[model samples]
Target chain A: MLSTLQDEKQDPRVKRTRSLILNAFMEILPEKGFQSVSVQDITEKAGINRATFYAHFPDKYALLDHSISQMFRQEIEKRMLDACHYSDENLKTLIVTVCEFVSNANSHCKPSSLQFESLVEAQVKNQLQGLLQVWLEQDDSDVDAKTAATAASWAIYGLVLQWSHDKNKKKPSAEKFADQVLPLIAVNLRLAQPA
Target chain B: MLSTLQDEKQDPRVKRTRSLILNAFMEILPEKGFQSVSVQDITEKAGINRATFYAHFPDKYALLDHSISQMFRQEIEKRMLDACHYSDENLKTLIVTVCEFVSNANSHCKPSSLQFESLVEAQVKNQLQGLLQVWLEQDDSDVDAKTAATAASWAIYGLVLQWSHDKNKKKPSAEKFADQVLPLIAVNLRLAQPA
Candidate 1:
């Protein structure tokens, strides 16, 4: 996940092309969505050639993955959650952050299309796994960090997506939902309880 | 999904190589799993050079994707579910198929590793979406078939995976579990009422 962010030191032209394509993608997503936006649409909007777009992203899906990952990382860094160790308080904050991020992301996409949701799911789960891996490694746990992280990350992203989709009359607030599911999510980590 | 099966007309040598590599992969998977089985191990096991393995698969993940997709498709065909359209009976069968498949697949690996699980998730979900899309398109519905299929397929795969992971003393059998979740899965398709 960090490799996606470490491209900042690349050739200026490469960086310029990527930013242009990503900016155009963000602009077009609200109007057309992830499914309908073609490579040509992005290149045309970005004022770049189709080949230039291809050089940067294999397809719009790649662009969406990169874009969503960047935005989600930004969300994490904003909350200062990216570098933190695991704690009950931090976990609650992380869950709330994801809830708000998924909710806002869905609302911004106009139709909340499947393509959009799936892209969000992939990117969010990926970053969540990365974050959780770091947190798990910081403590002593016999459970495999990557395994625990993968399970927890997927579970958190799935639950948050479902929570964001809920429209029941008595739907719990995001905080309440997080609190309710916290134990289920925590068990995925299997932390060696600090003696 | 059909394209994966349409490779029969390809060069006999290409078919031979793929089968060899796949056979080696399956053998190693039970011993070392998806994470630890290196490209070299597969090539050496198959009695082919590393270049031969590279020519066939970009990486083990791709191999895993292909291998899992092929096996799961066979499971679908064995049950005669591949060509059928959606019905409650079919849906229930699909759910049970996934539950049993996941359960059996997990049992084959020593640790039920994350890499193994994730690859299975991707391949199964892809096939499910394709099958659901065909079923939804065969009938009229207010819901977008692609969108509904994507949503339903992911939800079904996710729920069945969780179900397979459940070892509670009171957990239902696969058939009973399918019957229980059938309604929840059906609503995602938004099927029109039968006249």
Candidate 2:
């Protein structure tokens, strides 16, 4: 769902319009949620007409997809994980990032519905798979990159989702939780190694 | 979503009614898919009234949940995997079972929508987590059983999903694929083991 103009070379006007629409959408999301926020609401908040909003996004779901993608990509870049290899330190950082992201998404959204959660999951997992495949390929592991990456991405996401939903008062911090499960997830990528 | 009467002590009449509803659902699912099939459709197909259908299930989603749970449980039991502890062989069998179930679900439903797939996913993953937790706890692993089970269940489901969707002409058989990924998944449960 990446737009061609999503890069730095895009026209200033296009970038500004997209940024305004995204900002307005994000502001309304906490108040009305992804389900209740309408196109008209977003357009009015952004000081843009319906046509301008439509030109930017086909609908709210598409907007959510784009927003989640951008947010998750930034999370990866923030830790410089997008350029990293399959080191233990990098993997632990990735897990922490995911834990923080899922936790933040849950708390930020007014009332995160199942639809919104699944949409975020789909976007995040897609990017996770891509980033993981690159890491696996770069490591020159014997295991099939695509399958291992798929399993690892899902495993990491599932664990963090569980962590985010933990109701226990003594729930561990994200870094602590990631460190506890680090070896478990690491083995999924390098199957030949002794844990 | 398991009914109180979903056991051997259940009344024969209740069992018969539930069976009829489930059978009718299984029959209509392939013809009309999950979304298009309604309570009326199930009732008519089962030669029962809407009230009788409602007596067994609250709605079509609940019916789908119960149906999937039964089917996957039966698959697990058929291999005697439910009665066993964590072993390399049993784990391989579980992965193969998931692959087969996912493949069957995709083919049985006329055009499986995202909603249907996600519903099935939630039900299957819940059961898988329960089963895996039992296995992990029985093995007395030092790792946290709850978190490890959650991760392993999602990993197995995700890998099988990717396998089911493989467009390659020479995609591996379920057994072969399971063998390939067995070590990767096994380590998720027993962190101390050497792969």
Highest lDDT: give the candidate number.
2
DockQ of each: 0.04, 0.45
lDDT of 2 by residue, A1-195 (tens): 233345558788788888888888889999998777899999899888889887878778889988998889989998999987888899999999999888888888968877688888888988999999999889875777887788889999888898899898988999888888887887788773321
**Residue B163 C-alpha lDDT in model 1:** 70
Residue A84 displacement (Å), model 2: 2.8
Worst lDDT run of 10 residues, candidate 1 chain B, spans: B186-195
Model 2, C-alpha of A145: deviation from truth (Å): 1.6
Candidate closest to the true structure, highest DockQ: 2
lDDT for each residue of candidate 2 in B21-137, tens digit (9 for 90 to 100): 888888899999997888999999988889988787878988887788888888898899899998898989899999999999999997897768877788888889999999988
Off by over 4 Å in 1: A1-195, B1-9, B191-195
**What C-alpha lDDT do the candidate models reach, one value each?**
0.76, 0.84
TM-score of 2: 0.81
